[model samples]
Target: MHKEQRDGRQEQLSDILGKLFTSRGWGRKNDRLRIESAWAEAAGPELLKDTQVLVIKRGVMEVAVRNAVLMSELAQFHKRKLLTKLRAAMPGVTLTDLKFRAAAW
Candidate 1:
């Protein structure tokens, strides 16, 4: 295949994927996945070891931390920064709040 033909096929595939994602409402899910993958990067290695994102619903993210102390620390000191990082990483999704909780896992 020629270079021009390959470029056109690539563009067509991109458009088809975009439409499929939009039609199935996967865009939000993709954004959530991006945010989830970004958590460790945003929180740093120390915080990442203790924290896990449980769910994101209605613009609120519920995060589980290893202990109450860590939870409190995140709630008090890191929530806003994490939120900002999430917002920057996933601009198409609205992440309005973070809820931190102590986790058994």
Candidate 2:
């Protein structure tokens, strides 16, 4: 009822929500979504549609491409530019490299 009581309750609510997000892995999910969005923007819609963001182990991001030709192009030519764009887009994310694999899906 009092201002102090309301403020304390608000702080407690904030803490509870923060813990819930962490415990439920919502934070990681959000980070994944952000990463996907950044990848989509950087890779362009056409490339994104044929590729999937598999995982991020250490600082390397593993991407699955639909075909060997695209995979080769990405790995051989676009790798550097893509990495730079990804890093710039996701400044907080630790993205050291992009590894592309030919995968059927």
Best by lDDT: 2
Local distance difference test, each candidate = 0.82, 0.88
**lDDT, candidate 1, at 29:** 92
Q: How many backbone clashes does candidate 1 have?
A: 0
Which segments of model 2 are wrong by more than 4 Å? 1-13
Q: What would the TM-scores of all predictions be?
A: 0.69, 0.83
Question: Which digits, one per residue and each the tens of the lDDT, describe model 2 over residues 52-85?
Answer: 9988899999999999999999999999999999
| Residue 78, candidate 2: alpha-carbon lDDT | 95
lDDT of 1 by residue, 1-105 (tens): 212354464345677778789999899797667777877678888888888988888989888999998888888998889899988877677889999978887
Q: Against the correct fold, how does model 1 do in TM-score?
A: 0.69
**What would you estimate as the lDDT of candidate 2?**
0.88
Question: Whole-model lDDT, candidate 1?
Answer: 0.82
